[model samples]
Target: MPDAVVSGTVYDGYGREAGGGLVLEGGVLARVLPRGYSGEADVSGAFIVPGLVDVHCHGGGGASFPDDVDPRSIRKAIGAHRASGTTALLASLVSMADPLPAIRALVPFCESGELAGIHMEGPYVSPHKAGAQNPAAIRGADPEELAAWLEEGKGFVKTMTIAPEADHAMEAVRILLAHGAKPSWGHTAASGETAAQALEATSRCAAELGFEGVPQTVTHLFNAMPPIDHREPGPVREFLAAARKGRAIVETIGDGVHLAPALVEDIHEWAGANAAFVTDAMAAAGMPEGRYALGGLDVDVREGAARLAGRETIAGGCSRLSDQLALFARRGALPFGQIVRACVAVPARAASIERAKGVTLDFEPGKRPNFVVFDRGFSPVCVVRE
Candidate 1:
């Protein structure tokens, strides 16, 4: 393969994903090599973060990717996400009564790489934390039905958000894990202790990625369940306290709203680069803030934030991973390197695809960065690259 090198300041350090002079022999990174090598391309002041992953997304741009949405519309939505540098994405699908028809219909396309994976965001959540998901679309989790998704969706199903405290949720979690789908607890009124129990239960169901087995996740951080009371410390708070037995774990949405900049800083200090930054984006992302539909529910976007119409609950974010990184960088909330690592390494770990990621390199303090060429600084630069 011919070598093509792109060089800049290496910001990300996970999955061996470096950002300086990434030596691409074909599309795979050959190495994070010396500067001014024969095939190197230089980009000064640029930072490299992962091509973002959107695990929770509905529509972006002016289109929706749901099965009911048109083919052309889906393409448009995906294109919008691509513009923002999202290389991996999960279709955070909303429910339509029973979701099987749409899942089956979209399977061929998704299997054929129309989407990275599917995240069933609703139809099994608390009505209170349902947010913008259609209550009409909500259903009680049937272990049998979840098993069908595990059977049919297969590798294309990355995650399924369920109300852990709800009926049959643990059974569904077991079935989902049996079929290689990761289970994330969400949209429940689970108390703090219950949340910890739920996490332990899911851990029992899924094989712990780390040596120590633990459910190892809490979706949307401060979003569903209860608020952190000094005495009670709700599900979100308890999940935030996940650290034990050398286990590398903890998840958070870095939309700034999901966890404030200060909270993000706190997480980085505690978890290092292991903390995840998910968009949890909805149809309003990459598009103007206004009215839209998320999972068959009415949503309104005001000031670029989507919320359930006529309610205080947030539906999802209206931004991309790039936007989150930009915000994090601008705020200087955490060390730039750590921020980049969270964006790159954590998401890749979540998807279990660290091997195929960008460039990889190890460095000593004296050495300059190994691989660093991404449009972390300029929008126009990214546009030009394509």
Candidate 2:
């Protein structure tokens, strides 16, 4: 196929180049051309980067991933986020009554590539730190049950969130490692030392099982985990230190509602390349302010924040990656390249779904042509898909 060109200040997903145009032949990137080049399409001053990857998102539009079993509903959720510039994402399922039924139902979606994979966010998490997760569904880690879920997923399940402080934590980590799944620690009350020990054990198991490129990460750090204290630092401090050393990745709900702007900036400075930005959005993402469902829990979206109905605990985000990026862009605290790296490269790498048409989270020549074009305000003008 002949190349179709889209010109702009091209960001190759890691850094910006002088080239202001990108050529797409079919869905693969064909060329990175300099300024003043002519192409099939042109948006000369727009910002261009690879399609954003969301590793941790519940649902969007009016479709809830955990509640809707119909394929059409699942497709609706997928379509909702895709329209907003997320080319790839995992369908996050929270704790529920017998989560396996829902897991089995969603297997086909992942197998067919409607979703990047299934992110099982619960049933094995800590009851103490269960934020929006249903406490009734929380339980101790069971390697046998974990193996069963993996088997049912048929390689469609990419990641699982486990509370590292739970009983049989090491064994659960080993189970996940053996079955080619990454364990993301969250929803815990573990001390820093305990968190470090659990992650170390997982690393050792990965090595013994010949697994590579699998690193430990925390799920929505500081939300489901204890706060950092000078006298009683918890997973937050440990995860930050590990992130700084490139030993781990930390997922942050960068939307200002979940974290302060200054704290978000601190994560960017502290974690550097290991910082991954996620929406953790629910069914209200593209919808107007109203009531919604997130894994069977009632949620209310008010002025951009989704919270439990009549409760103080946050349900999830109603904003998409574009909204989160705009917050950072508006603050002017970080470089453009850094923000794109957090949204695309880092999260994709952490979730193990980075491989896309001969390139992973990048917009270079020979890579898959999936990206979003934004105007000066960072609003998504258009999403280009192969």
Candidate 3:
């Protein structure tokens, strides 16, 4: 006998949707029934998608991850994103002089299963493209510091963002792979050739280590990097090309503020499942427009966009992954199925959270039930996890 059943329009975490009913048993999806099958809960027209996975997010709910080390503040941030339907998340910390303390602070959450892992977005990036990062903290790649941070993470450091053009950056990439952590290329001014070289190095290293199917990502593509020019043709061109070929998964802040709807649509058309949508969200997400902190910098939020105080450089996002889904749906940029894959499956695969034991986000038999029910407007009506 089933513990419970939910009948609705169901979307497999990949790119398929059907009208059916899901049977829950022993805290897992025991069966998926065809349409017209009656159930204990009938959602009729609502849309059911796998719970969202955010690979890059600083904080939310009025708490900043990089600035707060308390477990309570961390839980507050996790609770905020979780309320918006993000079941799997990586607590991203910005560049700092020494990140071991912060990495230590986040490892408990990873052990307790409250967080998927930790993402360190660099002290090893190009100063020329630092974006909102504090300039004083930026430095050349240091393999020693990288190893210390990863060791202190206790195997919970899943990703680190590095600039391909930074000194000894390739060495740093090799170190991350050896430590079972993936490298994300961003905050860079690297030329197209340099970007291609880094991608090849990561691929070769991953293959040598037998780490097949593990994703190498471009952190929030086109945000801090140089724009593509016909003659110059910087890293953006190479990153997009890699994404189109499935060689890399590119993270796009699809909040409508970071990327125009048309550009987002174009990227999706080119990259398809390889374009992963991420929030890169900060403390202001789910909160009223006001002051917030993203690392060492103070930010002011107004009109739904967060920016550094007294500057125009856009800070991290103030929208959740669900809000990005709604924005893309409203723009009619891509099919709802594709958008769901970008927000759910792609990021999960990139972060390897989909492979975590007892945590598959699909509605497949024997997999734990982790999903969100959204109305026609794409607002989350119900979120379920087991």
Alpha-carbon lDDT, every model: 0.63, 0.82, 0.85
The positional error of residue 171 in candidate 1, measured at the CA in angstroms, is 0.8
Candidate order by decreasing lDDT: 3, 2, 1
Q: Per-residue lDDT of 84-184 in model 2, one digit per residue for the tens?
A: 88888888999876778878888887776667788889778889899999999898888888898889988867788888888887788888877778889
Q: After superposition, how far is residue 27 of candidate 3 from its true place, in Å?
A: 3.8
Q: Give RMSD (Å) of candidate 3 vs. truth.
A: 2.0
Stretches of candidate 1 off by over 4 Å are: 1-4, 11-19, 25-31, 35-45, 207-216, 243-250, 355-380, 383-386
Off by over 4 Å in 2: 1-3, 16-18, 26-28, 35-40, 43-45, 356-360, 364-367
Residue lDDT tens for model 3, 1-386:
23666766788778587557677776678887786665567444367777788999999999988998899999999889888788888999998987777888899889988898999998889899998888889998888888888889988888889999989998898898888888899999999999998998888888888785754899998899999999999999899888888789899999888888789889889988899999999999899999999888999999889999999889999999999998888778699999989888888888777765324456778867777778888898777765
Candidate 1: 10-residue stretch with minimal lDDT:
377-386
RMSD of each: 4.7, 2.1, 2.0
**Shift in Å, residue 220, candidate 3:** 0.7
Model 3 clash tally, residue pairs: 0
Off by over 4 Å in 3: 1-3, 36-45, 357-359
Ranking by TM-score: 3, 2, 1
